[model samples]
Structure formats: structure tokens, C-alpha cells
Target: MTRLVGYTRQLAPELGPAADVEALTTAGAVRVFVDDETADPRRRPALTDCLAFLQPGDVLVVPSAVHLSHAVTHFATTVTALETRGVAFRSLTEPAFCTGDEHAVDPAQVLAAVEGLRRRLVSLRTRAGMASAAAAGKRPGRPTVMTPEKVAMAVELRNLDRPITHIARVLGVSANSVQRALAPLPRHPDSTS
Candidate 1:
């Protein structure tokens, strides 16, 4: 019997949604291992488990190619190891390809298609949200603690040779805040005091 293992990090939300579906569709057993470990690459518990359970002809399904490696070198090493074992892999949401066989679908191609579609959808949604915000007259970015008029007044006071400590006291804000607000503009000559 062909065994299909769907593995994903526990923290990855994408894995959770598709896990049940993969198990239902596949005839073989499915094993999920949380790959969250802060240790030497060889000492990772999940990696150890995957190696132990893996056999020739087993198909490992992951959420994304990136989930397999923390870095390019690590990914390459992982691919090599899996290849040596004759274990194949397929990604659910990323470049959809099955490993093995002469005419296998290129994983990179699938990944690129998935990524491009995702980016376009996200961009459209972001633009729509920004437009709605603008229509509502809600200022974008973080909420400002001080109004622009107050900021202008603060700048004017700083130009009149008031000490930062004194300006902060008048503005009812911290000296640190005064410094932050004026960071982009040139400092007033009178501010030396």
C-alpha cells in the first residue's frame, strides 16, 4: 500500500486547514509532526521522527517548500536526504508537483503560479481597503497622539528658543516625543538652549 504522510509545523495555520482533507483523500496512513525545535539540525526531534517513519515510496505532503528548510543549504540537504530514501514530496498550496517518475511536474513552476495568484489577490484587496479608508476620511497609518496643529505649534515654540524640557511641558508630552516629531525637519538654531 502507498503511504502518504502530510507533515507541517504545528504553528502553521495553513497546515491545519488542509490536514483533514489530505487524510480523508489518501488511502495510506498520515503522520503530522510539529517541526518547532531550537537545536542543531541533526538533533531536531521532528526530523528524527520523519526519518524513522519514512520508507521508500512514501509521499510527504507539506504546505510550502519553505517549511522544509530554514535556509537554502538546509533545504538542499533535506531534498538530498529524501531523494536518497526514494521518498517523494508534494506541496498543497505551493508549487503543486509530485516527485519521482520521468515526467514529474516541476515544483518551482507550480510554486511560482501559486505565489503570483496570491500576490495579485492580496494587492487587489489592499487597494480596495485603502480606497474605502480614503472615502471614509479615516487617516491611514498609526493613530497620532498629537494633532497636526499641535505639532505645528510645537515646532513654532521650539523655534522661539524654548528648551526641549520646557516645550514638552507646554505640549503635555514627553521630551522624547518632541524629539521624534521633529526628527524629519531641521532643528531650530534657538533649540541649542
Candidate 2:
């Protein structure tokens, strides 16, 4: 017997993704799993449970292909593993990727390849821009949040035994940022390490 198991990480707290759940139910999902790990989707316990609950002959249905993995590039590898375990995949959005349909070849593979190509093109363009910036003696990527003046102030504040959190609040930055800035600061000879 083929069972459809749907999974989703995007949850609307107010209504709790009622529409997505209803759509999965309407699409014949025997069980629908929600991954509520907002801080880190990769560490979703529900996603792990969903995968563990799946068995051979079950179809893993998703609202979209993006729900399958943290990144589009990982979807192909994940779906390939599912296929290896005798499970199939279906997407509510991308109907072409549905397996067990009358098609000469698996469209999922093609879709995955196409997405990979798109990502590669983006990465190449970004790298080329960064290289050009480097050649012109301009640093690429995000500008430094902390400067020499900020570091000097941070060091002076630390010398006064000010807490990192307090200093961060004053500087309008995170404690972690402040900590990183002060990581290499040589302790005052009179202060305890």
C-alpha cells in the first residue's frame, strides 16, 4: 500500500500553518509532520521524526521542493536516498518531479540538475565579482562592523571591568561581536586574567 507523508517547516504561529496542513490532508497525506525549529531548521526534531517514520512504498510529499532540504542543492541527495530506500517523492508545486507517474524518465533528477546549474551560475558570478574587487585592492563581502576606534573603546571599557553584554548594548552590537573584538586584547598588568 502506498501512503503519502507530507512534511513542512514553515509554520504560521497565529493560525499554525492551517492552510498547508489542510492542503496536505486534501492531497491524501496519511500523516503530516511540522518542523517548528525556527532558530535552526537543520536541527529540526520533527524532520528527523518524519524521515524515521517513512517506510518502503511510502511517498514523501512536500508543499514545495525547498521543504525537502535546507538548500536546493541538498534536495537531490536527499531524494536520491529516499529512492534508494524504495520510497518515492512528490511535490505539490512542481508536478513534474512526481514519481510513479507515466513518464519516460524521472523528472525529479532533471529538476535537481537544473537547480544545481542555477546555483553554480550564481556562485560563479559572485566569485568573479569578489575576485575583481580583490584585484582592485578592495575587500569583498560584508564591511567590518567593528573598526579601530570601536576596538580601542572596547579595550578601554574592558580595562574598566565592564561586562561584554553591557559594552555590546552601549555599542549597539551583539555580545558575541564585542567578544570577538576583544578576543586578542592583552590583559592589563594590574588586572586578573
Candidate 3:
């Protein structure tokens, strides 16, 4: 008998069983692995065990395709491994991912999947690059207009009893910006006397 091994996971976006066990059992899952903790391969023991337990010719039935893996890269890698191992995939929700020679999925859905993967990969690379730049003491976003020179000029103009609006007009900044830059300066020692 071909084993219909089932797997389920739920961690975020409201906790509870994310996959339907009764549906998997009805779908012919002799053994079902339930992981309530994490999708991280090293952390989730049940998922590791489930992957190890699966054999050739066995069908891995999942309630949804999301239960397969967490990240987009990991999801694709997992699917590729399953395909290489001759283990067919069966999704109760998304049937388009099935290895069976079934004539059902829209061509647009396939294109969307490829596009989504490409986008995710690009996003990951961008994030990594940004982080690398940050670690090297480089800020990623728009440079701030509040330079030390501007703050110093505001302080000197304020000491000379210049109007905040006049100082702001000279600095090409808002009066509020001038006020903010001057707010944190040390108070005059004689003013407290």
C-alpha cells in the first residue's frame, strides 16, 4: 500500500492547527506529523522526522502548500528534493503543485509563481546587501538634512538673539527644524542664577 504521509504546521497569524487532520486521514494518510512550534528545519523535530520518514513512491499530502516550507527558497528546494526522490506531492487546497500528470492548472498561475519567486529572491538579496552596508557603517535611506554645521549655525544665531524664523530662513529649513536642533543644547550657567 502506498503511504500517504501528512504534515501540518501553525505558528503565527493566530495559533491553532493550520492543517486539517480529518481531511488528511480521509485523503488516506496513515501517518500524520503535526508541528505546532516552527517551520525551521533544525528546530521543528516533527518536520525533520516526517522528511526522514518519507520514502520513494510515497505521497506527501499537505492541507496547504504553505506547510511545505517557510521561506520561498526553502519551499522551492523542498519541492525539488521531493521531485528528485520520486515522492509525489498532493495538496488538498492547491492541486496545481501535484506531481501527477493531471491536466488542471492555469498557465497564468505558473507564470505568477515564477514571478513571485524571482521577486522574493531579489528582495532577499536587496535586504542582505542593505544589512551588509549597514554593518559597514553606511546608512541605507535618504540622508538627513540636519547636518552638524546647520545645528552649529542655529546655535550661534540663537545666542545672538536672532528670531527663529530668521535663522530658519537663512538655513533654508523650517522654524520647527531650527527649534528641534537648538532644543538639546546645554543651558547658559548664568541664566539659572
lDDT of each structure? 0.63, 0.76, 0.74
| Root-mean-square deviation (CA) per prediction | 12.2, 13.8, 6.9
Off by over 4 Å in 3: 38-42, 103-107, 113-193
- Cα lDDT, model 1, residue 166: 88
Return the lDDT, model 1, position 120.
46
Q: Write the per-residue lDDT of candidate 3 for residues 1-193, one digit (tens) a residue.
A: 5789998776443546734777788899998898874345336778788889999888888886666565666767887898799787887876566664553678787567556555655664576568769889999986766699999888777777788899999999988888888888974444431
User: Model 1 — which ten-residue stretch has the worst lDDT?
Assistant: 8-17
Q: For residues 27-120, could you state the per-residue lDDT of candidate 2 as single tens digits?
A: 9999999875352645778778888999999999888665566655567677888888988888887666666644345667667655854574
TM-score of each: 0.48, 0.53, 0.54
Clash pairs, candidate 1, are 95-110, 95-111
Q: Which stretches of model 1 miss by more than 4 angstroms?
A: 11-29, 37-43, 106-193
Model 2 TM = 0.53
**Which residue pairs clash in candidate 2?**
none
- Candidate 2 least-lDDT 10 residues: 9-18
Which model scores highest in lDDT? 2
